[model samples]
Target: MNTLLLHCRPGFEGEVCAELSELAANLGVAGYAKGKAGGAHAEFVCSETGGAERLMQGARFNQLIFPRQWARGDYLALPETDRISVLLQALADYPQCGSLWLEVFDTNEGKELSNFCKKFEAPLRKALEKAGRLVEDPSKPRLLLTFKSGREVFLGIAETSNSALWPMGIPRLKFPREAPSRSTLKLEEAWHTFIPREQWDTRLSEDMTGVDLGAAPGGWTYQLVRRGMLVTAIDNGPMAQSLMDTGLVTHLMVDGFTWKPKQPVDWMVCDIVEKPARTAAMVEEWISGGHCREAVVNLKLPMKQRYAEVRKLLQRLDEAFKAERLRVSIACKQLYHDREEVTCHLRRL
Candidate 1:
């Protein structure tokens, strides 16, 4: 309980730490360690007895940190042969061979690391087979590349190798504590675990009416129309013909912030380029007025004050809903496709 390992989508390390800091303020963290796993993954360390629970409650946690995942560390400075022996031994000891993820990390100064990896593939694969674990590729084991400056080499391992470790399985929440979706731009087979079709169905309405606030290219709108929902796309730009061809989205050449549905829609989605507060207010208006039962929006954060902006936005949204005597379940996250903003989904509680 003294230490807990946290993981996040790469490039979001600073935001994750900022989020952890806020959560820790309430639950308290003794200290932390941060690093990267190639370009796609990052890790943080905190105490389980410290602010782990609060971190779990943060907007980043639902989207970044997997709650039930366990990570253990093994640091060794052994020779090439010993390193191979140790890893093979660890794999043999592991109850589930498929769950073993052997990543070799060394500092930039370690010129022999690549050669070490080249030399150990045979032994590792043989040991894996002897342990009743199948190595998908005996010759080319996927080794994550990274650089760290320290005496000891640390090999981090995950016990639960579920879809959560897949490239596309991570949920980048739209808003903090709201519904999550895989990146439409980077959409691929790898994302099947990121958001199962079942979860997507729950968030959709078979007969729901809604609007896509920034539906230009129609990524979000495509999802809505496929669910048999009619959408009024409120954008100043042209939408994709395929989206328009769905014959479900009505293109509106009007400002998203100023436009209103003829009547209350069942849902409202926004991916507008606007301030976080402005976007939050729009959502607040729709949710508070019962104009929409559910919403998915993205807030563009300032280069600085990213965490502060996130905190402030959350506070404002909560207060606005409370004032209207309304309850909402919200999720906010830094999506894989997202750069400087977070995606959010708000549903009436």
Candidate 2:
């Protein structure tokens, strides 16, 4: 069994570790060991050959900690250039390797580390270049360099890996590359953790209907329509012409709190830039009254307690639903595109 190291985004080590653990459990990865690197990175070792591939295939695997890896295969003394050359040769033979990155880790305290990094770069770069693939910028290359000590160094290369991440409750979602103008933004759809449409089952209700609070731009409404559901968009602002053209979107120019569907709908989706508590309260009321069968809401967070606030909100939702004698499934995730808030998804039991 090959040793696999999994790395995650900076500052999201804990969440990433949770993600990885979940992956391991679901994928049957064995011999796992996890830790952090000064709070900026999370690292875990697994013994599955396809572990890295599984991690990358999932949408959750955003950036590479070290995309590819090669074992040093030796320990004793050797010249820096010779060591790098030997590692580079192994990298060239590594079937999964693409472009290579260069960095030398100084685990040997007080050693001449910078010198090693500089000397190692030239030959490594040359070796990769001779193989017909040029090394791009060192700062953000597909390859990653890391070391535990003089006795061990890890070299990683970039390649595609597959993991059926969605079956494990991870949403498959991505962000838009360009921001839209105000008028166009209304038509834009923003789903935090949208499962692929094909994955939604009858148990989740395809006949679901939705109410989009602050729907002036109709971005959230589009998400409902795409699911083959009706949406009552509530806001005083103008909705994009495209949404109105869809006919599935209904524009209601009224205050969200004052506006309620004549009958309960399947869901309520909100994107109002308001206090988190207010948003939480609104959701609580709707669920308590049985106004909607499910909901997806956004909570705008303060600069601090961003993570803590979301945690508390979920706890409250659980308690609120319990008091009403209802069972609910809820998920909160900080989307790759989210800045100051998180998206919350809820389904009634």
Candidate 3:
């Protein structure tokens, strides 16, 4: 197969392509990306056979910023009748699969195919098991049957350990009614995406102290407060009375960009509306100056060439850290709750 299927947000299909193009060049995998602007997925068409698989093996999935999921597969068209026989024939030469995933694009059109995928999954699994193509081994490759339409599908394989944990790489999170704004989900998702669940109790414990910049209305502050951490909410605008009543928050009337904590803080978060590069630079000061040991911030992306812009910004920060001789871990993601911005997490070591 020569195509690597990549799932991304509907409006950001170009980013998926752009990100892979740069990444493939670094891995020495020759490929060009092509896809529709509003489509929920894109493909990196490798120039040679097996090159797609080589790219998959060479690039680390977690390091990828745009693609939610990746699978190397071949496009196939199945007959309306006896689909099972045709599918089985296509996979007859393939190795055993650890698990089967029935996926569709993350668009409205794709949601309409959900019932069909649900109905088709059971019989398909039975056929694979009967043919000895399905197994219980965790180390085996995963079978990805991505349905683009009723009879159109991409038959692909992905390494389970290297792929996203959730189907279609979309995590399901229910918004808490208590949060002051929907933006609260962004910070919550950041913690889950950037920090391992096993480390949550200690890293995000009640004993920690947090500061929320541009914390008007207290959306992000609610998350920190719920963790039982005492938070300093810095904003000139009014904050939510409910959060103020909690008594765990100190509402300071100040500018997030210019304000500095009196002493070092355990966690500092910013959801300020500003240029992406400027927000990143501010976070750098917080980390390098020892104002905060950990931070979660959002970078509002530009209208065009966002992938290229973020890469340059991150490269600039990397150079700065190297010069300062500091150890810090930084992760960024376009979260499900985010629109034109990306959430970032930075931790000092």
Candidate 4:
């Protein structure tokens, strides 16, 4: 009854478990995390009564790196004959929810259950309303029912403010047909994830200037151009002629690692395929050395211990900035559009 369920990208379940186990232990909530590799989900079972509450109270969702989303509640194994009754009974003692989201894992089997979830939603809502367990108040918590299979489900709850904006932590972003490459979506997703939408007008204005490293085919550069920023795109390879036609980009054939802007720019972006540590160090230089006021860089991860590598890199950045007495804010996430890498956003405060 004291389990915390976490949803993550498939194949990173071990990393998620490692992260949550460490986090829970650090917060003095004795627990253990369990999940098979590639399960796409994990669970942390607390050792004592109300441990889940304490764990949730101490942990900040945004600070967690491995898990895409999480919820804390009691687990319920439903009867085959009347599954709806089992759900209602399990929720009897819980508070009313402003909304309900029926979720499944991010696996092939989970996708197969999508139709079931959609069909079950209406009846579930009707039952909740009839039983006084559902409300329309945004201030209330949202009920999250995560189904692992037709007969197994985890009944959990999360505050809307503390959870992901969309179900399953997936944002509904579309690829622009005009963009030169599919990689453009990665940068677009990074913006939506890292920068608050309301602050975009001021922080990402068209009047700013930017530098895009490894800008071949002009994927990341296109995003900057679309935002109306003047871009200096550096790469040894060719860029899309259509992007060049915009008259907003200056292409320079040079090494991304060695190339530097003559003066400080508004933003510095890189999507080069290289060791993640190297990319992280480059980003640190750009931010701490005052080359750019802000940056969004991608770190190509190793196959093993990806989360550990990310933590180490972030720690390295923090220590480097602290030693220089620089005021900076940093955030990182494994974006949905990203594979074998994670995106980071750094801004000088």
lDDT against the true structure, each candidate = 0.56, 0.56, 0.90, 0.89
**Candidate 4, which ten residues in sequence have the lowest lDDT sum?**
59-68
lDDT by residue for model 4 (11-71), tens = 8888888888888888888888999878888999999888887777787776777678888
| Candidates 1 and 2, the one with greater lDDT | 1
With candidate 4 superimposed using the best TM-score fit, by how many Å does residue 71's alpha carbon deviate from the native?
A: 0.5
Off by over 4 Å in 4: none
Q: Estimate, for each residue in 167-208, the C-alpha lDDT of model 3 and write its tens digit.
A: 888888888998999889889888888888999999999999
Winner of 2 and 3 under lDDT = 3
Candidate 1 wrongly placed segments (more than 4 Å) = 1-11, 33-60, 63-84, 88-98, 101-183, 186-199
TM for every model, in the order presented, reads 0.69, 0.54, 0.96, 0.96
Q: Which residue pairs show backbone clashes in model 2?
A: 53-161, 53-162, 68-156, 68-157, 69-156, 186-217
> Which regions of candidate 2 fall more than 4 Å away from where they truly are?
1-198, 201-207
The per-candidate count of clashes, in order, stands at 15, 6, 0, 0
Q: At residue 316, give the lDDT of candidate 2.
A: 87
What clash pairs does model 4 have? Answer: none
